[model samples]
Target: MTPPITYDGRHLLADLYGCPLLGDAALIERALRDAADRAGATIIGLHLHHFGEGHGVTGVALLAESHMSIHTWPEHGYAAIDIFLCGARHDPDAALQSLSDHLAPTRIVRHLIRRGEAP
Candidate 1:
């Protein structure tokens, strides 16, 4: 049997297109940290990985509420991002906007998921 899913929080999934220079892990990390702060979320830790020169980056910011993560494809000019927070006290949409502003993507598709819901 599959495990049940939770709906006690909000999760924002985003696909960013037409992004320029997606290989900078440090910049993405900073942007996420700033976004978390703007959303009034307490950040616990952050982890980031760079694929290689002119390749891509993957990053995750562990927050007191939950976590936010991002992966990029410089060659394709695309990025996938997830901003999941465990309560309404923080705005995941606002955090997502902050990241969009920092990255300046030409197109963005975002979806919000309710987590920890009763079965």
Candidate 2:
């Protein structure tokens, strides 16, 4: 019998649609904090920038395990988010769920990828 292989971490790519507050930088930052907490990921730093009124926001949360990034398209009511964590203790799904709760998007699509495989 062979042992199962495990990678160093997980990477989640998520697309959210029909989001109403895509231009809100403060809200997005708060959501990132909530997401990090839900995933049990330690937050090292955070940054967010809003292009202008009726535009969009870009944000990133630097975590001890890895990072989470979010970019929004207000006109399209869409947001693309990435959550990557490098430890077994973190749950990217939980983080995504938290984001969904805060953003209240009508539709969401996401994918999970295993990261850091040795050749």
Name the best candidate (by lDDT): 2
* Clashing residue pairs, backbone N/CA/C < 3 A, model 2: none
| TM-score, cand. 1 vs. native | 0.90
TM-score against native, each model? 0.90, 0.92
lDDT of 1 by residue, 62-91 (tens): 999999999999999999999999866799
Please give the lDDT score for candidate 1. Answer: 0.89
User: What's the lDDT for all of these models?
Assistant: 0.89, 0.94
Which ranges of candidate 2 are over 4 A from the true structure?
1-6
lDDT of 2 by residue, 28-56 (tens): 99999999999999999998999999999
* Per-candidate alpha-carbon RMSD to the true structure: 3.4, 3.0
